[model samples]
Target: MAEQMGSCKYLFMSLLMLFQVVQCRVLTVSEIVDVKLPHQPKSFRIDLVHRDSLISPLSPGNISSTARWKRVLERSNERLRKFQLDSRSYSDKVSDIKDAQAPVSSGTGEFLMKLAIGTPAVSYSVILDTGSDLTWTQCKPCEDCYSQPTPIFDPSKSSSYSTVPCSSSLCAALPQPGCSKSSCQYYYTYGDSSSTSGILSYETFTLTAQKLPQIAFGCGENNQGTGFSQGGGLIGFGRGPLSFISQIGPSVGNKFSYCLVSTSDPPSKTSPLIIGSAAGLNAKTFGFTPLIKNSVHETFYYLSLEGISVGNKALDIPAGTFELDSGGSGGIIIDSGTTITYLKQSGYDAVKQGLDSAVSLPQADGSSVGFDLCYTSAAAAFPSITFHFKGADYVLAKENYLYHDSTGVVCLAMMPSSDLSIFGNFQQQNFQILYDLDSSTLSFAPAVCDSL
Candidate 1:
């Protein structure tokens, strides 16, 4: 009788366990909907196409390599000239549109990005410029506008579009703010005398599948420029309160990253530009350099370039050669708009001397290719170049600093400047670059940009 009771108790316990399992599995519809999962960080990504790419509307199809390199150098020269002239303080405010002579230029940025704006999204191609501040696009009903391949963005069609009043703090953030009645107006002049004047407004910016609302931008009714004819307008990635990155900083955790593909790659291949939480960027793998601050010109991203190396030998560059002075004159900037890197005369000389000593190949004239250093043999092995930044050593692949022109001559892809030095897009190719404004750091790692 005792054994029978024990068996019955065991059966009861087994049935109770099975009932509990069934109860847990049979969740109500509302209860299932309310269940929480592990949190995942969100990121937005877009493609960055080279302007000369076949996929880009700006591409001059079938152009010779010599012609392409010449155009890049010309634009670089214009961009550097603008940077030199743009030394004015951002703190200075302009009371009216007439008083606004702000020095900001497109310099014919090499990369183009496609995004949509407004309530009913209208797609537009725009220059992806890291050196610029305000994101502006040519709008409909133009007073004066440059020729663009696509239809101009019509603010009237955008239901979500709204103009900022002159009294709003958003309007006050403009370097040179103007008042057209109660609406805030803006005027910006490029280095090449290209200009854009329009009302300051807020709209929804759709990048990829993500819709970012309430973004401050310019609706340029009067716009004139040579380089801007290819694309609709520009999207600024500069360090300023009015810049696209700054406007989206809160949502993105003040982080952004990009990987530029080599120009030698097929024009169809595209690089990726990411904002918010960047994936595959582990701190252990990336080398970081602190970003230097310039009080006078706050838009540009400055770096401390301690020195450079050719092969194994470090160039003997004088201290403070790349330093940003109290007056904000000399410094090194990483610019995405410029195709070829530019070093100050002194620094360039040191690098040129180092290359001359390291290279054993027969010397060739690179004047036609817009370079000072050239080698007759394109297939010959060459020494690697490395940029020595503070707390980081960035090694460059042969493709980064050397290019084989259409004439079958390999040339150094760097130039000399009188005042400012720029680390341009060529050197940055095939590298994943992360800009963390929160940490005040810039991190980079070698990557196959196309794969990323």
Candidate 2:
């Protein structure tokens, strides 16, 4: 069983970032094409290291007797609350393909990137979130900031640092709306009550041997709530115009892909996040799904989920449940920050029955676990679930579809949604998922993530 609250700190901060998407407006390069900048490397690699991989096995002295179970229940509650909040947020149809809340344990096992910011090159560990678009870090001279492991970055020491003026086109894209000051300022709040406010600026960003000049980033001087973690800040890789991909669009060719290790696997394993044209070679693995863009929320990446098949039979759910409608109806969203998958009610029920029929294990009560479809059986055979996308069928193994709780109960990892359905990162484990904005298509191919 996975430890829960241990990672809640990262979860809540990521939650705050995603929530800001709903309130902020993105002003992208299209609006500021005339702004000339410096040259950047055509392609390079950023080594990703998962913090969990560094942890030692929990000894008896490390955890209290009941603390483990309590953590599982608490984390489960966080997942339910997040699912409900995101369903409502997406249903509200804030005019995007969309926004979502992640499971609390997500950050505990998520991949982190080591980034070098400023001309002097101050380094910090940051979470890489495909679900969000803005890249920010806690800066020095803060009015109010959360505690971070690294010394807060002081932009004044960096020779290349320059604040974006309110008159600049990038400032107009900010969610802050009216700008009275010369510096472009942003105030972002999350559904969980955390907020970040700071000045927008461009800085030199370095990852290993590659150095990217004139990268736009938020230099947060005033941050509240889950503002920072051991992973000092977050790097958003969303489809938005202001996202990492968008900012590096010219160099990367708008293509990137990652293969997440199975959450059930030990954190000792790390994965690759191939950027630029190199990700294009992953297409040879097959199982290509056409990607869709939401007109309203340009940052979100959307995919059509045709149906889910249990074994050889498809569930008795309606196809329209996964369809993206302009009326803000139900649709499927793919997000990496989320640790579990969520299905609409009818679809969820059908899958549940299939599990109940296929596995002979007695159904364990899930009240304390915060979900349904759990059992006490060990090494039981679980019906493999295949998510039929637009043109590809991505099948999941027993390890990917089942959850082992703290109390020796194995439960279906997926949750039931009232309206919105999300393809969380958990299901994408060991799959090389390619996001290509150039062709507007996402592809997937199974691979041993550790080998990647």
Candidate 3:
């Protein structure tokens, strides 16, 4: 779970950066040519180190007796009631695939991770993204390029930098509005509104011991988002050949897995992303759930939920009404692009009543949540809510699991709609979430997300 959250933080930050640099111009290389991969084989390797320990078991000493963990389970029935209609808009479309099953929890585990990339220049701290598919970075001739913390990947400096001719087969697949000729040019737009422009290029790339045969990326002539300060480039996770994982996937392991840590957590103990066979889940030791492919968005996974229950009482929500996207958070956005999560008034009332029983509250506005439970003053006991799905229960920790702008502040991160519920990262902490594209299933396990 920690690892997944770490990846989510990267994605979220990328979105935020994208929103800030929406209308930047891209510089183009003078040479117009066909796009093709390098013919030589380049190799590299990476060393990884595990930085976190397993979470201790929940026990009497670890929890407060006065307020039982289960007692804190509350349903914002009223909030959910009002948002039901909106929730439907964000709800995931059910899949017809036989293996398409709802998300389930197994056991806790961890993995070793190493990310490497070959750029036109000596690129440092280039960001890797599992949620996107195009790999790109700021380059020379960036007349209006914004300043950033990391150095740009200059193709001209690299001994191996080579252009992908316009006629190459790889250039045909660039996700552009008019991808007709081989005049390889790419324009990418991220959810947060970050945009980059550059001509396409084919290069021999290396990640650890693995070397991808042919890879294409958007070499931005100019870029604008510099807040991240870590990398001037983005490695996309989409299905194109330029995407980071897909290019090396068949070689790295057969799949990749990530759990992003919440931004709210301290950065020192930040979680690391994992890929390939190094992923800690031992199939032989842990349970396996069928992967369900999404019919509508071929890139996403779909699961049929049985229900969600808080202790003995099951909230009255339709099964198969929610969808989880591992790439998104801040809150669960069951968005198909348009609708938002709508928690009905009844659901919000039920949830709030339960939460209010254990924690005090401050007034609220649409923008922020103030708190009654002060983390600095005293520790507050919280309830344990089980997100029941397909007969399995995924447990959530109190601190990282439920979050507010401030402690005890009553605000609408989870807004009231009508009847539907949308779960995001606020509810995703301490849970090992696995998005398996090969099997088409979103899996979860109990975890100590403090590190992620």
**CA error at residue 269 for candidate 2, angstroms:** 1.7
For residues 1-452, could you state the per-residue lDDT of candidate 3 as single tens digits?
99999999999999988976863433245321222335422222232111121221111233331121121111122122222221232333122112323221100011123333454324343443332456766777775465654566666766556666766656665645223254577765322223466778766565544455456776778554322222345555543455666666554443544444543444334444455555444333323344434332332223334454454456665333454434321122221111112344555455455544545544344232222222222244555555554445655445434444333332323445433344544454445555444554455664554443
Which pairs clash inside model 1? Answer: none
Instruction: Say which candidate scores most in TM-score.
Output: 1
TM-score of 2: 0.80
**Cα RMSD to the true fold for all candidates:** 8.9, 16.6, 19.1
Q: Whose TM-score is higher: candidate 2's or candidate 3's?
A: 2
lDDT of 2 by residue, 227-319 (tens): 244367778787776677788876667788888876556545667788877775444567888887776555557788888889888888875
How many pairs of residues collide in each model? Answer: 0, 3, 86
Error of 3 at 163 (Å): 3.6
- Tell me the spans in candidate 2 whose CA falls farther than 4 Å from its real position: 1-40, 55-109, 178-180, 227-230, 281-284, 367-369
lDDT of 1: 0.84
lDDT of 1 by residue, 140-226 (tens): 889999888888999989999999899987788777799988999998876545778899999999887678778899999998756
Q: Which wins on lDDT, candidate 1 or candidate 3? A: 1
